[model samples]
Target: MSGTEALIEAAKKRAAYAAVDEFIRDGMKVGVGSGSTVVYVVERLVQRKNEEGLNITCIPTSFQSLNLINDGGLNLGDLNRHAPLDVSIDGADECDEKLNLIKGAALTLEKINVFNSKLFVVVADYRKESKVLGQKWKKGVPIEVLPLAWRAVSNYIVEHLHGKPILRMAVAKAGPVVTDNGNFILDVDFGEMADPLKVLTDVNRIPGVLETGLFVDMVEKAFFGTADGGYVTVDRKGERKVFQ
Candidate 1:
């Protein structure tokens, strides 16, 4: 890997390990989020379980996460049966100063996991941090929509919200990218978003929309791994705590 890629990978591991070590407890129900950074979280959790004999049930946000949990040798349970989780640890595509997150992939399931968790912790590398939402990750918001209503939803976002919405195309498949829920994804760009909460509400109000990537006011704490081999925790109250 390149130097920058190596740094990012190190940061991801540092942040993930920190979040797991700080929040996880024995016998608690945990919620695991998806994406690359979260892979480290699961790895650390499995290590703790094996070494310290930590007994915890994990709730996965997607099929990928479920596999990660199983492969990590951690106990897995469905959200429907085990919700109101003690804590949730996941990664973000981008996060603003206030801890508002822009999560990519499995947006709907991640939302449900965060909503059901009492303590929601986000983990990411330094590159994912920004002074404002959409500053770092500019790929736009990933909105999950029903397959049949995707065109209508795209048009509505353009005409009503004055945003550019594009259906996510699959790399392996022939057509649009279908989500795990058998739905479509629309990555909408609204430029620099000043009001993420309002944007999230407006987008979800559109017909056939399942969920948006904008995770507003759901995060309690965010752990950002610095390229310099350290980690910083930003709480909901905007307090910064650094750890090496």
Candidate 2:
């Protein structure tokens, strides 16, 4: 693999380690998030489930994540019944200097992921920048909305919210893109948001907006794999340390 790819692989491994160390507990309910980086966490959890006999239930952020949990031999549960998860493992598109994050893979997967978890852990490679949430990730923010109010939501995002939003189109198909929540998605770009938390609050206040990808203060900790074959962790308190 190339250098960046190797870093990503290493990051995945470290993320798995972090998840196994902190998130996994005997008989605890865990939340699994969608994305490439979270895949390794599921794999590690599965091994622990078999070898260590950890009896943990997992709630998935998406259908794809649900499959990962099931294939890993972890029990699956719906969020409706399993409120207040013990921990959640996820990946971010970019993390700022303060460890705040910008997520969603050109889609609104971040919404349901954040909603179901209590302690959200972000895992990423070193290349995931620590500048500002929007600086590194130029892709528009992902917004999930009610299907009935997509038009109103889109207009609000563009006109009222001061965003440049486009109806997400599916490259694989000929129709509008659909999210795991069975809702339509809008890719919105606000261009270097000065205050992400305020922007997030404003967007959420809209009638049809279910959630936006600008996650502010939701993450409790972050684990980043560096090129030097080591991992670094940043807690919500802004404390930084290296992890083996």
Candidate 3:
């Protein structure tokens, strides 16, 4: 890997290991997040499961993460079977000072997993940390909508909500990206939102909207991994702590 790629990998590993070490326990139910950074979380969880005999059940946020859990030899389960999980560890695209986050994957399932967990923790590299929401991640908020109502929702967002909405197209395919739930996605740019909770509520006001990437009042804590093999921890109460 290139130097930059290696640095990111190391940061991911550091955050992942720390999250797993501090949160996971024997026989507890865990939520594994999606994305590249979460790859390390799964690996670390598997290592702990085997070496320390940590008998934990894993709840994955997506199909990709489900496969990761299986490959890591972790038992897979669902919220129906294991509601109110002991803890959920997920990655974020951007995390503000208050611990609000922007997610990029199947947020419908992710939200369910997070809300059902007793403790929700986000783990990401330092690049994702921001002074406020929407400051760092500029790709816009990802919203899943009914495939038939995508245009209507987009129109509503632009005309009424004062946001720019674009249908998310599949790069490798000839059509739009189809979510696991058979819905379509729209990436909406609101431009430095003053109130993320309000934005989330406004987006949900439109009909046919399945889920939005904005996670408000959900996360309890976050771990931001620095480049030099350390972590900056932040809690919902706005407390900041560092571990090197």
Candidate 4:
């Protein structure tokens, strides 16, 4: 593998280690997040479960994530029954220098992700970077909204939030994209976000908007796979250190 790929592998290895080490206690409940890096963590967790018979419950961030959890042979539970998750391990599209993140592929699971978990862990390759959170992930911020309020939400994104939004179209399918929450999605492009938290708050305040991808101050820690088969750690307090 290339150095960058090697680094990503190492980072994923460490993230899986971190999650398994700290989150998967005996008979504990866990939250599994979406994306590529988190797949490794899920795999590792499954291996541990099978080999050591660690009893734990997992809540998935989306349908796809739910499949991953199931395929890993972990017990599944709904957030309604399992509130206050022990920890959530997911991936990020971008991480600013401050370790702030942007996430949205798993929009259906936002409420569960936030309310069910006490700690959120972000796993990513080092390449997911921008000076600011919104610069790199330019596909626009993923916003989930009530189907009845899609028009209002789109209008608010454009007029109030100064964003350019488009109805998320599923080209492969013949209908508007539907989120796991059974909501419509609006991809809003707000170029060069100055304050992600403020933008998130503003977007969320709009009627009909369910959730935005801009996650601020939510991640407790992040594990980054570097480009040299190494890993780095960043905490919510902005502390960073290279991990051996």
RMSD of each: 0.9, 2.2, 1.0, 2.1
**Model 3 TM:** 0.97
The runs of at least 3 residues in candidate 3 whose Cα sits more than 4 Å from the true structure, single-residue gaps closed, are none
TM-scores for all predictions:
0.98, 0.90, 0.97, 0.90
Ranking by lDDT: 1, 3, 4, 2
Taking the tens digit of each residue's C-alpha lDDT, what string does model 2 give over 169-225? 889899888886788888788887768898888988998888788888788888888
Off by over 4 Å in 1: none
lDDT of the candidates, in the order given: 0.91, 0.78, 0.89, 0.79
Q: In candidate 1, list every pair of residues with a backbone clash.
A: none
Ranked by TM-score from best down, the candidates are: 1, 3, 2, 4
Best by lDDT: 1
Instruction: Output the better candidate (2/4) by lDDT.
Output: 4
- Candidate 1 vs candidate 2: the TM-score winner is 1
Per-residue lDDT of candidate 3, residues 96-203 (tens digit)? 887888998988899989989999999999999987787888899999999999999999998999999999999998999999899999999898876999999999
| lDDT per residue as tens, model 4, 78-141 | 7888878888888888888776777768765854576568888778877786679767888888
76-104 per-residue lDDT for model 1 (tens digits): 98788898899999999999998998988
Candidate 2, residue 85: how far the Cα is off, in Å: 1.0
Where's the lowest-lDDT run of ten residues in candidate 4?
Answer: 107-116
Estimate candidate 1's alpha-carbon lDDT, on a 0 to 1 scale: 0.91
